[model samples]
Target: MLFVNLPVSDLARSTAFYEALGLSKNPQFSDETASCMVLSDTIFVMLLTHAKWRTFTSRPIAPATTSEVMLALSCESRAAVDAMVDAAATFGGTADVNPAQDLGFMFNRHLADPDGHVWEAMWMDMSGGGASA
Candidate 1:
């Protein structure tokens, strides 16, 4: 299983943003300070409030004002990549930091959550010959 922990300024807002992206919340590992968004059986995103996240480490938390990481997720289709970007924009997220890419057999877009974390939504085709991603 894979778990990506993100420090968020507001747990509620972050959770809502992720939910809008179509990830379901798993109440099993949620609390007032943190919530779990399940992307798949083996993939999870742990959204933690700044305060709650501090408990896990002595190092200073990376401010949401900058790009600390660029998380990438795969989409089922090229259209799905665009749909996810649209949903993200509708839910207070922004997809303007980078331009969209189309490599014939692959497509990708970048979106930033309210807290400035960037996510790349991608779709690829490996069935036959096509331009590289």
Candidate 2:
């Protein structure tokens, strides 16, 4: 129900970061000035310059370097999550120091993107969802 647009200093760098996550840019909404990253069939991320991005938001910005929120996405299988994490590493991302924990029905791996944005790649078993953690 919500489409998020993030502000970045460089459009090319931001595009590369999302591409490393296996997402493609929507050319229809993208141009040299901005990039519209396709997150899902309906979800989109419009990466805009700070000046243009402020037009859509009035609140103070959260610096990606110090912010604590790590965008998370669910994967269909454990291997898929691992692959994403591995790809991130291959694209100059850093894997979280801790390995993914297997609580019987859930698996997760965390990695930091090139811009220091943290993302969690996870998979949950529909059977239980691992109530404990």
Candidate 3:
């Protein structure tokens, strides 16, 4: 199972933002300090409040302006990639943080959540056996 733990300034707001992007909150593993957002059967995102996060690590939290990591997810279609980016923007995320990439068989767009975590929504056509440069 994949769990991406993220530090958020506001738990409720971050939970809502992720939900807007189509992930459902898994109440089974959620509490006042953190929320488990399920993206797929094996993919989960744990939104942790700054205070709760400190319990797991003593390192200073990276500010939103810093690019710590870029998380990527595959989409069913090119349209789905566009839709996700649009939804992110409508729900407090910044759209097109990076230039969109279109490699004929693949397409992707980068977006940033309210907390500045970057995500790349991508779609790829694998029937051709390999991706083109």
Candidate 4:
């Protein structure tokens, strides 16, 4: 809840990916070895080198080959969501293997960065009359 820490094989590459998404890093928590990405006022993402990240968790890291969890981020508008997905591609990332689907009240797309980490960009229409999640 307080923060989401992601273990990336290459810190620089991961940092670039996030930067392309319009997020900035807090220099205080960043160094040559790691980058702390500021997602919002309350949420932060600590992008750590695989080795450095392991030190903070006891469980074995999940291998992308067999298991993976896609992280979803909400956007303020449909255009914002599209822009992020486009930025990912320009930064050497890939559009979600599966195309986006519109669900009347929401529009969602998935994207994978160069390191094979998947992120979902989504937009919801609060005025569309759907119950808040």
Candidate 5:
């Protein structure tokens, strides 16, 4: 299983933002200072409050304006990628942080959550020759 941990200034608001993007909170691993959001059977996102995050590391937290990483997720179809971007914008996220990419066999859109965590929703046609591109 893959777990992505992120620090947030507001736990409740961040939780809501991810939930809006189709992640369900797994209460079994959630608490007042943290929430485990399930994206799939093998993927989970751990949302941690600033205070809770400090327990794990003493490094200064990066402000929302800076980015540490950009995570990408595969979608079932090109339309799904578009839907994900639209949903992000409707729920406190910035859509199209980067220009949309379309290369015949692959399509992708970028979005940033309320805390400025970047994500790319992508669809690719692996069966086609474009997979090499």
Candidate 6:
């Protein structure tokens, strides 16, 4: 199972932002300080408040304005990638955080959530997956 944990300033706002991107909340693992967003059957994203996040990490949390990591998600089609970017903007996310790229076999865009966490929406032609990098 894959899990991505992010520190959020506001749990409610962050949860809503992810929901706008089509991930559902998993009530079984949600509470005041944290909420689990199911990305897939085996993938989950845990949004935790800074206070709660500290319990798991000794390092100071990175300010939202300064990105520490970029979360990338693959879409089934170019249109799906576009739609996710649009939804991110509509839900108070900052769009175009990174320049859009189209590589014939791949296309991608970046969106920043309310707390400034970067989420990348990408689409890659599977036929090229086996090609040498």
Q: Each model's C-alpha lDDT?
A: 0.89, 0.77, 0.96, 0.83, 0.94, 0.92
lDDT of predicted model 4: 0.83
Give lDDT tens digits, candidate 4, residues 1-133.
Answer: 4677777788888898889888899999999778989988998888878788778887776665532778889999999989999999898788865689788688899888766778899998887567443
Ranking by TM-score: 3, 5, 6, 1, 4, 2
Q: What root-mean-square deviation over C-alphas does model 3 reach?
A: 1.3
- Judge candidate 4 at residue 27 and give its lDDT: 96
Per-residue lDDT of candidate 2, residues 1-133 (tens digit):
4466677777788789789877889899888777898878877777787778788779866775665566778899999988988888887767763467777688898887655667788889887546664
Which of 3 and 6 is the better model by TM-score?
Answer: 3
> The CA-based lDDT of model 2 is what?
0.77
Q: Write the per-residue lDDT of candidate 5 for residues 75-101, one digit (tens) a residue.
A: 999999999999999999999999999
- Give each model a TM-score: 0.93, 0.79, 0.96, 0.87, 0.95, 0.93
Which residue pairs overlap in candidate 2's backbone? none
Query: What TM-score should be assigned to candidate 1?
Result: 0.93
**By the TM-score metric, which is better: model 3 or model 4?**
3
How close to the true structure is residue 90 of candidate 5, measured as C-alpha lDDT? Answer: 97
Worst 10 residues of 3 by lDDT: 124-133
Question: Which has the higher lDDT value, candidate number 1 or candidate number 6?
Answer: 6
Ranking 5 against 6 by TM-score, winner: 5
State residue 77's C-alpha deviation in candidate 3, in Å.
0.5
Better of 3 and 6 by lDDT: 3
- Residues 36-124 of candidate 3 have per-residue lDDT tens digits of 99999999999999999999999999999999999999999999999999999999999999999998888999999999999999998
Error of 1 at 58 (Å): 2.5
87 Cα displacement, candidate 1 (Å): 0.7
Candidate 2: where is the Cα deviation over 4 Å?
Answer: 97-99, 128-133
Model 4 per-residue lDDT at 103: 80
For candidate 6, write residues 31-51 as lDDT tens digits: 999999999999999999999
Instruction: List pairs with backbone clashes in candidate 5.
Output: none
Ranking by lDDT: 3, 5, 6, 1, 4, 2
